[model samples]
Target: MNNDIDSALARFAGAEPHAGLAGLEDRVMCAIASRSSSSGLAMGASLSAAAFALVLGIVSNAVPLAEARAVSTLAPFGAPSPLAPSSLLLEPR
Candidate 1:
């Protein structure tokens, strides 16, 4: 068994690589370069999209709606109505 294993190992070590594996390194390098370039393009596109969304949000918030009215009350604007169920729970029973 040991002799058979030693012979098999020697045969494997002395074997020549297949012809189909020629220029494998060049092909692998080319594929890597192409993938890296595409990733850079994707990153740029995502950043530009985020910047556009941010600018749009800022512009939308800065401009007031035409149909909205300005109120002069001193109370907080978004406070819940006094008659609401949630507000009723806070009142003295």
Candidate 2:
């Protein structure tokens, strides 16, 4: 039994390691280079999208401010009472 185990161990120990995919190093380097180049494009697109959103947000909010104040002015204005039911509701009751 011990000899059988020893022979099996010897066979395993002498077995060659697997030969991996050919040109693996070149494939990995190419993938890294391609990713690095594409990253610049991705970054530029992200920045442009952010800038456009900022501009749109500013325009949308800015355009509404004056109109909101005008609409509010046309209604009677005074400080709302703490106990007012209308104030508690999202819209005027």
TM-score on alpha carbons, each prediction: 0.40, 0.35
- Scored by TM-score, the top model is 1
Decoy 2 TM-score against native: 0.35
Clashing pairs in 2: none
Give the least accurate 10-residue stretch of model 1, judged by summed lDDT. Answer: 68-77
RMSD of each: 13.3, 13.1
- CA displacement after TM-score superposition, residue 46 of candidate 1 (Å): 9.2
lDDT of 2 by residue, 1-93 (tens): 579889999999998866786688999999999899879889999999999999999999878755434323323457665556676776656
lDDT of each: 0.85, 0.79
In terms of lDDT, which candidate is strongest?
A: 1
* Candidate 1 lDDT tens digits, 1-93: 579889999998999989989999999999999898879788999999999999999999899677676564434457666667777898998
